[model samples]
Target: MAADALPYPLRLQGSGIVLREWQPDDLEDLVTMLDEPAIARWTPMPSPFDIEAGLAYLKRAQTGRLSGRRIQLAITVDGGEPLGEMLLFGVTGDRREAELGYLVGARHRRRGLATAALTLLSGYACGTLGLGRLLLRIDPCNTASTSVARRCGYRLTGEPPIAQAGPYGPTSLDTWEYVEGLPGPRRQRLRNVAARRYGRRP
Candidate 1:
């Protein structure tokens, strides 16, 4: 699929939520969500996540979208109440891969929104973008994220703890990596359906 043939986002609405692009106004809600310790502990965020930092990150996310390297979505109910955020980063064209990362607000945990949205996005990536594989990385300690990956049919390939830059300071983080592909019989059936409906071949 050509880049122009795909909708950069293509809003997804279901389960009383709409997953769409990041907006300047969303900074306030995101700031509040990031301020929660539940979200901060497992993910990488500044020690004291504040409004200013949130705004800056929002701007960077927009930049990432414009450059065609990333998609950062705001998870919200259909009526505009914010829930959380999810991101897909295109790692390499040669590799034909993208990485899935997400965080749900404390109040929205245990709902199927995360898994559902992820499933939809994974389909879009494969069907619309013609990607062969999607990579999901989860912090070793984040059982919720790991569970989401497993439930969505990603197979764990490795467990490696590596150092990466963080908001506060450099820290070692362990992550479990998983991959999704369209080669399997079940995935091929779904891909065929998407091709017929979306007018594109994956």
Candidate 2:
């Protein structure tokens, strides 16, 4: 399982956000998150995403979890209402790399929800899952997502944009990469009793 995908039906707690698998009760809220003009513009999520589309999406998400093909989570706070979605897909065979994507409801934007959720999930993917790299494909025009990716430590390289096939067919996107671990040495030093820890860049 470690080499194939994330732990099935995962749940994680962060400082202010929670990452969890989809549930039956989240159907309506799922619709709320995906069925928006912004979502349609930025994502390959089904257009006119209604209850029917939500049902299909729920089935797909659950099945993906069961098959260990990919993982998607509901982004929430205090385990309350579902406000957005975060997903890791296109996993490499060794599970050392994968693509990450997220969406927040229109009403829930501009509150640092995306940053909180992405930061939490990125930590899990690197630390718990031992992933060496996570990829984020973004359209340059979508400044909101670009900002979120940058804030969460995803960096754009000289690598040219690639065309990826999605539910909406092929689209060109900028590739942003997130490598595991912190970039610099530890700031605080322990005295003779202990050793200070530093992170290694992948």
Candidate 3:
């Protein structure tokens, strides 16, 4: 339940993909995923995301991991080129809750990478990290991400969207929750999927 609950150079693999910590060489891929109209419209990522912004992001990711505030990982295949990113952030002081976020490049949509990446991270968070709850905030209009969250057993709390300042501009976000030990068919199914794919979680 400490900030160090997340190890450095973290690598979690499952559902035919690998999610690992960011590296210096991943700047291009990182920028590619963030520097898009849809990414900007749907999420809080910066517009005109470029190499320089990616460098700053990498530094923040390292600091987040070391300080136990958050963890940002690159979603890749076979540990090769980065396809996108996944994050576990907003870890509460009690270490009982956190948030999940992800993004895939424009070319990589519809390939199920987002779903696979979420499933892997969701399992790692609830199983190994032992967090009591994991949640995500997003605009309801982003059906792609909303679908991924539901498929991974997150349910909308039915509360109103919260308005806040994003890194780029004003944003409104809907909250969804995925609590540990929640009894339901979808939860069980995800567990089965994780077991079948992630024989070892680390």
Candidate 4:
């Protein structure tokens, strides 16, 4: 999608986190966090993170937003810190399914930021976007994220025995799948409030 096609603005919170679009200024922070050994260990990030890679990622995320392929947010606490990212991707033709992906900077782990962001974002997907299901592919060894998924109401479906490479990977990693979102009035209300708070049309 073209940059012109994206109309939604950044969404902010009183807690100092702003669910916002990618900016040129965020490249430095992205490089810093993505280069962390622990962050790179579980995630499919480039091993030797650099300015060029960060810029490229920003561009792709923006384009994905424009095309509706994904709705991505830069997770920042104390506002504008780019500590991590959360994404709703794999939107299909019917708009019935999408997958969730999240990565918090090693520094930001264990702070409930992931849970808060996931809850907020999941509501947005179901309420404003009207998606029926959200899937999560989690690394089995990452117990923290696994617990976060459960806390956010995702139910485990099963686990894959070995690693699975994504389209961009040379190797595969073992994964556990979980899903959330079915239709209901409670979900509608959550979406309504989120839409109003985030300046999205109800």
Model 1 alpha-carbon miss at residue 38, Å = 2.5
lDDT by residue for model 4 (60-84), tens = 8877876756778888775668878
lDDT by candidate, in order shown: 0.68, 0.77, 0.79, 0.68
Candidate 2 lDDT over residue span 99-143, tens digit each: 999988988889999999989988888888888778898877678
Q: What does candidate 3's lDDT look like per residue over 68-185, in tens digits?
A: 6777888898898888889998887777889899999999889999889988888888888888888889776677887787777676655578986655567778887784477677
Give the lDDT of residue 144 in candidate 2: 92
Clashing pairs in 4: 162-174, 163-172, 163-173, 163-174, 164-172, 164-173, 165-172
State which candidate has the highest TM-score: 3
C-alpha TM-scores of all predictions = 0.77, 0.83, 0.84, 0.75
Could you give candidate 1's per-residue lDDT for residues 23-134 as a string of tens digits?
7888788888888766666667775789888988888987777776777788876738678887878567664767877788888888877887787777777766777667
Alpha-carbon lDDT of model 3 = 0.79
Q: Model 1, which residues run further than 4 Å from truth?
A: 1-9, 14-16, 165-202
Output the worst ten-in-a-row residue range by lDDT, candidate 3: 193-202
Best by lDDT: 3
